[model samples]
Target: MADNDVSQLSASQQQALEQFTAVTAQETKDAIPLLRRSQWNVELAIAKLFDGEAADPVVEAAERAAAPAAARPQIPPPSPLPTPGPSLGAGSRNRVTISPAPRIVPQPTAVSRRPSLLISLLLFPFSLVWRLSNSFASLFYTLFPFLARFRTATSPPSRTQTTRRSQNPRDTAARFIRLFEEEYGTDTGLEFFEGGYAQALDLAKNELRFLLVVLQSDEHDDTASFNRETLINPEVVEFIKTQNIILWAGSVQDSEAYQVSAGLGCTKFPFAALISRAPSSTSNSQGMSVVSRIVGPTPPQTLVLKLTTAITTHSEALERIRATRAVHEAGRAILEQQNSAYELSLARDREITRARREAAERRAREEEFARAKAEEKVLLAKNRIAWRQWRATTIPKEEPVGKDTARVSIRLRNGKRVTRRFNGGASMEEVYAFVECLEYLDESATDEETPERPGGYAHEYGFKLVSPMPRQVYELRSEKDGSERTVKDCLWPTASLVVEVDDGEDNEEGEDN
Candidate 1:
């Protein structure tokens, strides 16, 4: 009320008071308690000079007027209620309802008072160490392309040292696996091997040993005892080979298999436990690739799943695989050389056959020419004899030729006869030429060059006990089946050489002695 109104007001204004309160506007009239209303009694001055009583009145109603202020009150300006409007289009059987919101869950305490320190630390949201380790590993893999990434991870902070988990191990593994599978998927590239694989095996020259585990299959090759549909397929082998991942077949023996399992941190792997030997530093001749399989307590099929999971979680085992798939380079080289030699030998044989055929043809032509010449010579000799007879009969007088012929006979060794005949030629040139041609005709001239003796000695130096040929001498001879097992070439080791005088002496020599 205004000051003038307050002064003019009756005793009821004496108790009037101003106070703040909260209530539903609809119930504003009745909501204000009678006692509180009584506080607004006697002229019931809301404030300043008032012309009306308002259950909800504004403080501005108390104007600076000393006279009573004009006041009018309707239901308090519709208490700002939310406007109801059409929601979007869809219709549900039930009207769209906004149910009470779920109770807000209190955020987990950063430091839980109930948890042990170790538990809290372990469960700590910070995987920074792991992330960093992973990043560093990924960087290393990228930098060293040939370094086959495997399950590589630092043991979780082994006591004192900070450990790093491969932050992006999956990424690295996936990359390696992709590359490996790509390379190995080819025929004989890196797959289950049989006999031919043995030859291929000879080509590997690596720091580690690669063992192709042959998981058995009962469908076609029933020899395999491992479960069907669970065979260690070529894809797995390719994956291993591409990654330079060692292909190891698990062993049936649990203890022996445990070594592999423990190393892999898994009970199963892609391969079956059907191997001749657990993958080790040793070499194996058995066709382990396709013959052996990965066998475990778990069905063969499940082994792969477990193994994959293990590899995902563990990194050390993967590195071990990389370390083991090694090839034997030296042996492979030797085998290649042998193959080359064999091929060369085959080529040489083909050339030799062609040459022999050509030689035979030449020989046949030469022989035919000689026979015709010989027949012509015989006919000429007969005609000369007939002409001589005719000349003797017709022109008996003039002897006009100075011609002579000489024949000599000599006895030779071996009771053989040697006859020498000289032809009456005008000069020696003709004979000399014939002799030269005869020498050239000798077939022995066509022989290949003789090999020198061992120890760089000439074959002409025959005085030595060891022959220039240096033939392979054996100590004894023993034959088995049809082949000769030995020869007595090294008999000199026990026998002494000496000149004997017991036999083959003439009677005259005996008398002289």
Candidate 2:
């Protein structure tokens, strides 16, 4: 056997010994199947050596290399091979049989996929409920037009465009101004005023125009908030009252604020409110052109809906007002009815009082007429007595002091003076009075002959002029032509020229001075 190269043991005998020990108790003791298989290879080789087969170093060496190693089994990572096919051979056989491992088609993991089905099932119920509820709600709301016919309609809703947030106040203000200008119109004339709001308010005050402060006052960003000091001042109110100016109040958010602003004072689209196209008016047939507010420009159909809605709202409000008025009238009528009964009871007393008043008025009028007639008779008699007295006491009786210039007067045209004569018995007639002129025998009484009066003559009587009130010679003139007149003696105050015709020039030949 030693001479048989010691390595070449007969394969048939070695196979029989390995098969016997492979099922042995030693291989089974405290070992997993793979471990037992590994130790058995060494155990079988040793048995063969002891059983009269000399150790073949080549076989031993080959067994050491070929046998499975006692090492930690590791889980193989997923293969990158594109397909599952025969990759490695199990044994050295010329005719190879490959048992290809089954391909595991990758599926979605349980973590991501399992919850989706449950969630979908849960949401299905909710969606079903929502759809059902929505349909019912819509159906119910649909009948509101009929149910709420008496209720006032509201303005069609509009949404403000979302503007980008900006830190710059000027940028915000400019954007706001642009929006207003666009919504209203291209502001021409007084449209695009970049002046300060507070300054404009102050300027408006000077012109007797009041400003409406429409804003949330807590916000310092609004100009109206800055005018708080002006708001509470009594003097401001007084000034406003005297100037025929008024302050309007409302929230900026309300449409009434816009309406009120339009009514009072607005720099933009003043003509729009004034020459407003009524909501129902289809064609702007009037020659004046109008543009729609671009804040939320709507098509004609939407605008028509809005118009009808507005009309309905206004009509409702008017109806409410009328209903209130009717209620008030009924109450008043009840009060009047109660009062009428009381009045009916005192009808005889009222008639008696009325008759007494009439009688008293008649008696007073008769007495006044009798007294006036007597006064006229006495005045005429006194005039004749004055004439007799003049005849009796005569200094210039031969020349007749009035005969030298009988009704002397002066006429003025645009302050240029001319002289004439007049005939009557009295001084120059005042502007407010219509009477014949007087031949003044007294030189001191004449305006031109007497120097300019030192005192304000008319105010001494405690009579001030009012509308159509008379000014009684508040000023008098001393002239080179020896004729002068009072301020009131002028034709009109607007024209400051005195034009008394032939009044007193001739009578005042010279002043005593």
Q: Tell me the TM-score of each prediction against the true structure.
A: 0.19, 0.15
List candidate 2 stretches off by more than 4 Å.
1-124, 129-342, 395-513
Top TM-score model: 1
lDDT of each: 0.33, 0.34
lDDT of 1 by residue, 1-513 (tens): 122243444454323322211211123243233323335532232221122244443443342232243442222222222223222231121112111111111122233358788976886766667778878977997798555213212111111111222222233234333443463443434433222222323322222233333321111122232322333354543455554434423221212222333322332323332211222213434322211233332453355543343233222322333422211244466789999999999999989998998899999999999998989666654453343233223221212333432232322212333333333331222222222222222332453532222332211110111112343222112333433321122221122221112244322211111
Off by over 4 Å in 1: 1-305, 309-368, 371-375, 384-513
Cα lDDT tens digits, model 2, 384-497, are 334423322222321133433332222222334333332222223332121111233343233353333222222111111122234333223334454555432332222222
Clashing pairs in 2: 407-421, 407-422, 408-422, 408-502, 408-503, 409-502, 409-503, 410-502, 426-438
Candidate 1 least-lDDT 10 residues: 97-106
RMSD of each: 42.1, 48.7
